[model samples]
Target: MITVIGTGTGAPLPPDAEAALAGAGLVVGARRHLAAAALPDTAARIVLGPLAPALDAIERFLEKLEPEKPDERRPVVVLASGDPGFFGIVRALAERFGSDRLTVHPGVSSVATAFARLGLTWDDAVVVSAHGRDLRTAVNVCRAHPKVAVLTGPGSGPAELGAALRSSERVLVVASALGSGEEGSDEEGAEGEGAGGERVERVTPAEAAARDWGPAVSVVLCLDEARVLSPVRTVAGPPPGPAQWALAEGDFTHRDSMITKFEVRALALARLGPRLGEHVWDVGAGSGSVAVECARLGAAVTAVEKTLDGVERVRANAAAHGVDVSVVHGAAPTVLSDLPDPDAVFIGGGGRELPAIVTACARRARRSVVVAMAALDRVPAVRGALVAAGLDCDGVLLQSSRLAPLPGDVTRLAATNPVFLLWGVRPPARSEGVAQ
Candidate 1:
């Protein structure tokens, strides 16, 4: 049997974990964890690096144990940081040996300690582990949500996170060396200095990216200071993805009745499939109604509009809906080069450059792209562009009529203009998951 103990996040080892370590005949942990513990002189130690090797070592140790006399066998303990079950070594161990043969003891997560240092409640915050994973999802989550805790690892550290968030107005709280008794300096008003070796510092994204914050960093909190304190949330994790989506035309601020109709917008949204930790692009964002709706659905959105007024309209609509949307004041196909690749894209208006814009968006979109057009002439070109970009193309013609109050106490079906909604989905093999 194996015992997994979570520690090193400024918490003392529980008595249960201590007792397990005392009897451990073989111990496995990171160098820091092993050095911090008092292991028996007879017990063997393995410094963990690449997990497979350590698992192999543990397997060898377990195989030598006499299965019939379980009580006579010395304990095998693996030490980990924070909650071992949370993006830690427990999963790997369980998969190799099975859960029935192991016991676990959890410690305070770095995310919880970081938030506590700032006197903030983390119930409304989204916690993402960027350790050994793509940083794009964490960046997009920080962009879309007000509060986020990122578990940093090597390349995905505070500096990298700060660089990605340079354009965004966010305060990064870098908490390092939690519970270590290291001396703290007053840089950036570092706090929590007393007996605990923790240093909590606040810096802007630019400031954070400017310096090197060694291996001591425990966690980074990316917060939109304006909305850092959210209302009491009954359900956690990204605010439950907006109660309703595909809002009505009257709900948004548009110009000259120039917005995607509710029916067309509905289908476009369905194809886009916006959700937390994903990025969506709305090209030719007229009035930004579609962009606003996508943002409301908890995806990081960038609304590109050529007209300055249109950009402002998109911003206003996003603000009105209490969502964050990066409004880019420029045309697509050219402006898209500066923006990050999106998981999904919605092209509403592109005029003569429609096919070019669709091609540009389709090539960069990781999952799917949806194009809405009124002119049948552009349909073939758009479809060709999607196909050339290696996307599986599909389309629909939406013709809907809404009930309108007419003459004398009666209602009539008002026919709306016909729209062609074309959607291109990347094959599963080519598609990227949000957590990637």
Candidate 2:
């Protein structure tokens, strides 16, 4: 039978785990884990360095055991650090071999150990692992949320996380080698270690934000304002109604030519349903009105503008609205490459490359894409691209007029330039499909 045992990190194996290893016939685990477990000398042992080969070894072990007599009992132990179930090897094994085929023994996860060291609780903190090639989602989570516990890997470890959070004002707490005696000790042992304890540094956000840390590092980020705690907050503005967004042009500072009219912006915001934990890209983010409004609605927004003056204006507008927006200064498709993928995207310029950028965004988007077009000639091209990328397309023409003082003590309708908004929604999976 396959048995999973968690080797409490950087510490001796617990009594029960050590007993199980003593009776084991086949021991499978990383070299470090195997060494730490201190298993009795066994004939069968598998060393796991890389992952796929380790899985292959486990599969082979199972295959060889299938022919053995049913009455014959053989103990196969798998050693893992922290809790095996948490972003660990247990999930892979369970998926490949049925969960019923194995028994899992619990041990202290690194997250638990780290928090215990700090005398903290983690029920409220978001736990994420930057293991393997999954750093993007972790980075995004840190960007969108306040309290986070990150499990680090070799390349995507604490340093990478610190670098990502450096631009923002936040607090960072890092703990490494918890339960190990090597790194001096906790406050209790500090007096004994004396001068040696001085090397064990507990860095603040400002210091950690400046340096690149090493592996075996765990980090906690506390943002300036814990906005992620609540999904949405009421901003001081007109109440939610049919007039959803796109305030009158006078509401924002713009170079007249650079601003997207309020009527069209209303539709664009509607299409781009910005919410907490989602990312939105406002390409050609002229005046930054859309990006600012999206940010107000609580979505993490990145605004890309090309011109030096336009970039400055977008920042000013965002500040005027008392919202934070990451202003990216560069041209689209090119600039977008460096930014994180979005849940929704708004293309305000670059009609020729709108199709490509929209497609790229569609491939990455978890929900929707919205593009604003002033030139009617580009609608069909953008629509075709959306359709090709498996998105349902729709468009609307918006025109609005303001009441103005006339020559004869009366009001006149001052017509504004019309705008066309094109958008697409990626179809949900088949299981989520609804009846017609």
**Residue pairs in candidate 2 whose N, alpha carbon or C atoms collide under 3 angstroms:** none
The candidate that wins on lDDT is: 1
TM-score of each: 0.93, 0.63
The clash tally of candidate 2 reads 0
Q: For residues 1-436, could you state the per-residue lDDT of candidate 1 as single tens digits?
A: 8999887776788898899999999999877678779999889999877779999999999999998998889979998777778667788888989999889998777777778888888999988878778999999999999999888776888899999999999899998877566422111112222234678899999999999887677778999888878888898766876677778899988888999998888889999999889999999998888888888888999999999998889988889988999999988889999998999999999999999999999999999999999999999999999999999999999999999997899999999999999999998873567566
CA lDDT, every model vs. true structure: 0.86, 0.68
Off by more than 4 A, model 2: 10-16, 66-72, 182-212, 218-278, 283-299, 304-324, 327-344, 347-369, 373-394, 398-419, 424-436
Error of 2 at 36 (Å): 2.2
Tens-digit lDDT track of model 2 for 236-290? 2111323345676677888956788777887888889887557889888888889
Worst 10 residues of 1 by lDDT: 184-193
Could you tell me which residue pairs clash in candidate 1? 180-197
